[model samples]
Target chain A: MANKHYAMVIDLNTCVGCNACMAACAMENQTPVWKNSWRTYVHDLEIDPGTDHQVRRRFFPRLCNHCDNPPCMSVCPTGATHKLDNGIVLVDDELCMGCRACSMACPYDARFDVSYNDVEQGKEFYGELHHRTRPGVDKCSFCAHRVMKGLKPACVETCVGSARLFGDLNDPDDKVAKLVKTGVAKPLMAHLGTRPNVYYISEIERAR
Target chain B: MEGMFYSTQNVWTWWIAIYLFLGGLGAAAVVVSCLTNMYIKTHKELVLWGNISAFVMLSVGSLFLFVHLLDHLAVIHVLNPFGLLTKPDAWIMWGTQFIVWMMVFSMIYTLPYMLETPFWRDMPLVGTILGWFGWLGKLSLSFHKVVGWLAIINGVGTVLYTGLLLQSFPAVALWHNPGVPLLFIISAFSTAMAFLLLVLHLAIKREEDHDIKVLYERTDVILISIELLIIFVFFHFTTYGLESARHTADILWNDMGWIVGFIGFGLIVPFLIEFRGVTKGWNSATPVVLAAILVLCGGYLLRHYFMYAGSYERPYPAINSIHSQSNYNLLIE
Candidate 1:
């Protein structure tokens, strides 16, 4: 809702998910390579038996959709989870109670529990020092820190396919808006009440 | 068949469901026990003991609910208790509110008794009223959205959360189903009965009353019947549908012999002894203890299998399942 609302439109028709985007994101954000990164790829979906299992795998790279009406925010007993007008659901690092309630309410399984964790000394995690900072939640921030300085998402910038497109949807003339007007696109889980902002192109066999 | 939508519940869902069941069970049990205090001495002791369980249920229950609900919304927000009748989402919001109040009333009514204060014990009617009020409040949360509207608020929450709680992982297929709500409610009922029997035996023994021992023993037969039916449906129904679900059934049949020991030997044995006690017109704790332990084991194992078995990836039969899909673009955060 600021200068422009950002949204992602995935072109499933042209995507050759080479894991380049994931690595770029981790490097740019200094995120650890552990399971709880800001982004993840839920690939290897084998829907049917064919020539072999290798060919059946379908990649589904994911990050938070930064939905318009997120359920995760409403169920927080404390004011720890906050959704900005710009469509970002933020977990205030300081106020989280380490309660796993929001994780359950999330239909998308977006909330990750950083709990029961112990810090190990001298462990170089993703080129950064690994240390437990207490238990809480973590997920993609849509690169807010980078967005403040005026730049595209690190993944979009480094993408080889130009398959991932991001732009202001509020503007009719914007790139994302133009793509939306013309291309066949889909969202991951459309049935759940949460109105996800991310869009996809081409027919996707999503888990209804 | 096309893939349908579903969820994989994890630890968070479990926390919420357990909280709801404990509160609902504790509240409902107290209401029954407290209300019948005048007619039966066993009921009086039950009313007194229900206080501790009520506290345990309410305290731990609300903790998990709040943890999930708070983060789902941002900042400071409170449910418009009035909108519960209008909006579907309002159901959960309101159900949670009702549970909290019931917790409050029960705690307030029982504190003096817990502390052995003459004030609360002297006014038994007030205590009874509190228990009734708590029961109504807790019961409201259990209403399904059909009559209640939108989604299953408290009851379905208590039930399906158990399923989703187990289903979130791929290991347990039995717990993962659209049929989860029904299964959970049945299991919860059976488990509650198992606990009730144990508690009732104690309450009755304390009163030195043998008249109702036969009734308690009869109830065990009913509980056993219900539990077996539940288990049968859970295994047989799922086994016939999906192949992956069948594997889960196999896991239960093959490796869950300990489950029989727990449910049959432990629970059934006590139930039988209690039955014998009734026929002889005597009181016995041995049967009650055995049944309680067995029922508890059954409940825990039921959930455990679902969690572990749900994680197994099943091979789906399909033509050209190995078709190399073209790499597609995805939304970057």
Candidate 2:
């Protein structure tokens, strides 16, 4: 196979705001549940609130963009944040000094600090099988561990509406590649030049 | 409506602010002390005390930086030389190297003066320690000029790194401007003068050091005036440059700390005091000392408020499109 360039596409139309992805991510990643921080979460957005038009609800799920030009990786003093050939960004816990510079540099607000206390709490919250063994800056890894094992991310696998799609963007046959090639899905804040791998498909307006 | 979609960055808190302030102040003091020793007239007391203060301030500041880290034991990772070679553009890596080298060169520069001091030469434990390093001190004195230049270069690097560190964070609109580094560099020098003034008045009250005091006062007056102009430009640029920057400006302007504490008390108060002392030939130590103290406080407030005022850009531009219409508003949870 050609070099894999992983990507994700989230179709806003199909999402039901159930937050299954958030729960699955928290459980699989051993996130700080008590603090309510997650690798991915659905934002409950109110559009045109208090306007003459009917108020509309939008469920916007957010996670690390895994940008081609990752600022977090460049700003990292210890080179703790690194990108794989497949375009997945990962943080080496042993090398991360937890300066939170990566958190500040990320435009997506994806990175979160996992303190020593958070690691200690993970043992109890995750029932002693917690994989988070050290304190460092944490973020969505695109579930690289599972992706390498030929399985989808926890968020995509558990998505109830099947709104989240994950695949190798390099493969022209992949659905993600088709959506992107056809311009049906768009990346957020493209003007920022981060070249985000995560794309979004907007909801189609119903005929009045 | 934009407030709901945009969030203030909370990653860098008062710890980073304190570190930035102390780092700039310490580095500037070292630069000023070295320049004075080399060019004008050498005052042993100023050189000795100034270097000591710089060393102590930087040490305390680095300690705070270490405290800010969640993984303190992993600090060794920062010291790895390969990181610098790999990511040469990373300011944090440069900052770490600058701070460490600055401290090392500063100590070497201070070694000869420390050995010459009667306090160190006569004190029981210190005298013995000096005796052990007698050959080293002779070596340092032999090439003191080279050591001084190296210290000066690293000191300047450390001072610039403090501002460049913030400027590298493009996500925060308030910190991404070139004006930040300019403002920080000027403030660093200004604060250094104020600190030296305090030392001159309180610790080493020598009549022979009148020229030095006058030089510092004159230099500070010019620096403060430039800083005021820069502050004006900073606010103007942020207000008109980008929407996210305007939001950060709104936050900063509304805070009484930035207004009354930094601008009114910190900048204006000290500027008037020092400007008057320099122009009118007023030799009173009382008001000058007061102005110096206020300047120091102001320097710290500058970093603290700027850190707190950093606001991240809206994550998604689609929200902008939806909210731009007159009848639309976005409330993000």
Of the candidates shown, which would achieve the greatest lDDT relative to the real structure? 2
Candidate with maximal TM-score: 2
Q: Model 2: runs farther than 4 Å from truth?
A: A50-53, A204-208, B1-4, B122-128, B315-333
Q: Which ten residues in a row have the lowest lDDT in candidate 2 chain B?
A: B319-328
Model 2, docking class: acceptable
- Scored by lDDT, model 2 comes in at 0.85
Model 2 TM-score, 2 decimals? 0.93
Candidate 2 residue lDDT tens string, B1-333:
342355565446677888999999999999999899889988778888888899899999999989888899988877776768887878989998888888888888888888988886898987898889888888888999899899999999999999999988777778887999999999999999999999999999999999999999999989988999999998898788777777777778878999899988889999999889988967579999999999999999999989877766653332210112211122122
DockQ of 1: 0.09
